[model samples]
Target: MAETMTTTQTITVGARRLEVSWAGVTHVGHRRETNQDSFLAEFPLFVVADGMGGHAGGEIASQSTVRRLHDVVDSADVGRSAIEGALERVVKDIAAHPETTDEGTGTTLTGVFIESDDEGSRWVALNIGDSRVYLLRDDHLVQVTTDHSVVQELITAGKLSPEEAEGHPYSNVITRAVGASELTPPDYVTIDVRAGDRFVVCSDGLTKELTDYGIQHFLRQHPTPGAAVDAMLAAALENGGRDNVSLIVVQVGDSSSTEDVHAE
Candidate 1:
């Protein structure tokens, strides 16, 4: 994988403005023959999708969803409703695709949508399946999206511990995903944005290799998104790289207040 690089962009809504620096990287990993993960890092939106299916179905599913989102975002029509509608359309399109019909092709979708109103700027975190969205604020990292996987349900039901779930055979069996069903709806939460907030949106590959503490350690050590993303990818690859790895790190703050940190 190449060294991670950061790109700065700004999101404005009404009278509110958010200066955002972000970086994204994806790898085929040590085991996978093909990369099935796809991502988007445009301003006002960031996404990570982990695809699953037989043959090329996984790749197709992930790419299709991201392309649809790119179109919707490029049209300047963005919001909870827009995202939901776009997902619905993508599902329909996938079902009608010759290669995906009856093949059970699907992809996990997770990320944040930036929105602004008269009050101020806010972030809407969205999720479907096991891919995750995490927030680092006040030096604390919190996972904002819940996984819709068998292991997650087992953990919630008190049938499994977090440590146990890590090695569970059903850990990869996601219960919900985009394009898996026409009725699948993503879970979302809207929260007020704060300066100095950092977000990590990633596939299960990274989490499978590192614990929350490990992730936070790198995030804190690498102050800039570029360095943080690179450090994370290197760690995951070193740990095992058992599956395709994809991630996007985003930091929000005033332009002058945030300093870019690069890895040597």
Candidate 2:
């Protein structure tokens, strides 16, 4: 097998009205021939999707979901409600598409949208299935979105312990996904924004490999968004990256404020 590799990409687009930096990484797992995950940082829109289906249907589903999301965002300036509506619309469209419908292709998407005005910026997270969004504030990590999957539900109902859920046979069987039905509702959460807060959007691959302690330590140590993303990906691979891993790290506030955040 070719040696597993990792790469990073960063873009600084738009005016300096606000400082925004994001980093993403995706790796084809040791066992898979094609990567079925996708991550995007389209300025105000950041998304991560883990696709499922047969053949290359998974890949096509994830890519199509991202493209469709971009289209919706492009046509309208959306708030939290609008974002949820867009997600619902996309899922319906995916279900209606003949090629995808017959194959039952679907994907889990966790998206974060940030908007800024003269006052400041606000953020909301939209999620379907198990991909996650975590917020880091004052050096503490908090899971902002609930997983819409069978194992997660079991854990919630106390039928399965956190440790047991990890190895469950149905751990990957998601109960909800975009395009799973004619219309699927995303669990959207509006989070209070603070200047020093940071957010991570990642596939289950990273969370599965790294403990919360490991993630918080690495993220706290590497303040640079790109560097943080790289370190997280490296650590996941080091711990037997059994699945494709992808992550995006974003920090709030201006560059100077971000420096202050890490200086603490």
Candidate 3:
């Protein structure tokens, strides 16, 4: 069985109160015995982690990473430094875990966090592996994160086309990840936020079943975060969910109106 966690939050940034909401869900999929994926959809932080290694190790790696980030969010300080510090700790956490300290134990971390100041707000996206962050604005969709995978590298080198990389045996091989015996800081991108913008942070499990166009179609078909999430999950499952599926839908403001960044 799968579980969905939907949350609607209002965070005050400076003098402006921002209406930000997200809906998240995770499933083990048809082929997996256990769901090694984990996520955090709390205010100011929406992230997804895909654990790698064996069953227990994968779970530990993902949980350790997500739990550590949750601690940072709970600490009332959300920033690049805070996040990077927490992830650095996660490396130690995984290594410290007796059951999952093996070299094969690691997890891909990706997502976006809300950063606000007296001037307004923006989104900071971070990723360590193939998991992705996508943005939809003006009814257009774009992938905001570059995948860190061999297929991606091949595509970049012009040795493979995006279409040919779909099932290239190496499609699942990632270049970097947390708790992989090395400290690789996540790549960060700061995005300007708008009222009607929508963001999706998800594991490759979801992407494996949905193309970018399929994702865009569902997001437009369902307005609210929860509805969009439900639709995407169903479609993914119906389309032969071969791997664990996890996703988060973030909406910046009301659907009926266009808004701008503000601190009040």
Candidate 4:
């Protein structure tokens, strides 16, 4: 089972009243031998991390980052700057860990922190590696985070087309990652939100099995957050369950207690 939480806040933005609620879900897919991903559901702050490395090392790296982030977000006061600083600290902690000495363990992190403002809430996203965050609203789906993998670089340099990069031998080789590099920095982006906005944070496994068009179509059809998740899981399994897949979908503008957000 899964849970959803909502917090009501009425903010005026240029004579328009915006009511937004934030909700999220995290799931470990069926075929993975171990779960190397984690997420957070605290209001105004949400995150999803997917780890990589040989052996069980990836799991440790991912969990460490998530735990540190939870502690920072939970203990400190909430604000855009505070959240950003916390993220920086988490990245530094990962890079400095002792286990990263051999081959270097690494993880992809995608997180969002929302802050109430006079106009509405501001959404800030921080990302590293290949994990991503997507924003869906007004029937449009936009990828908010760009991957930090080798294939991404080739695409940027005009050496690879989006389709060609998908099957490239070095597609999975990432240029930067938490714990892999001593001086890794995340790419952070900000967006303004209104009442009916929804967000999805997912690992590459999910995207590998489900195309963006497929994802966009599913979201457009599934009205409830839970149903959308179910459909996504089903589609991935149907595609052969190649790797561990995890995802979190959050809706902003509804209000409820924290407990409900983890119910399932």
Q: What TM-score, over all chains together, does every model reach? A: 0.91, 0.82, 0.91, 0.81
lDDT of 3: 0.87
Candidate 2 regions with alpha-carbon error over 4 angstroms = 1-18, 80-89, 92-103, 115-121, 254-264
Candidate 1's error at 55, in angstroms?
Answer: 1.7
Residue-wise C-alpha lDDT for candidate 1, range 1-264, written one tens digit per residue: 555889998766444576789999999999999999999988778999998887778887899889989987898877877888888878887787778846679899999877655666567888999999888987988898889999989999999999898889897899898875675778887756667889999999999898999889999999999899999999999999999999999998762223222111
Residue 262, candidate 4: how far off, in angstroms? 31
Ranking by lDDT: 3, 1, 2, 4
Superposition error at 211 for model 1 (Å): 1.0
> Whole-model lDDT for model 4 versus the true structure?
0.69
**Cα-based lDDT at residue 209, candidate 4:** 88
Candidate 2 lDDT, 25-83, residue by residue in tens: 78876656788898877667888998877667678678877777777578757565666
Angstrom error of the Cα, residue 162, model 4: value is 0.8
**Best-fitting candidate, scored by lDDT:** 3
What lDDT is reached at residue 155 by model 2?
91
Cα misplacement distance, residue 5 of candidate 4 (Å): 8.4
* Model 3 spans > 4 angstroms off: 1-5, 12-17, 101-103, 254-264
lDDT values for all models: 0.85, 0.75, 0.87, 0.69
Per-residue error for 63 in candidate 1, Å, reads 0.3
lDDT score, residue 190, model 3?
76
What is the number of backbone collisions in each predicted candidate, taken in the order shown? 0, 0, 4, 10
Clashing pairs in 3: 15-263, 15-264, 16-263, 16-264
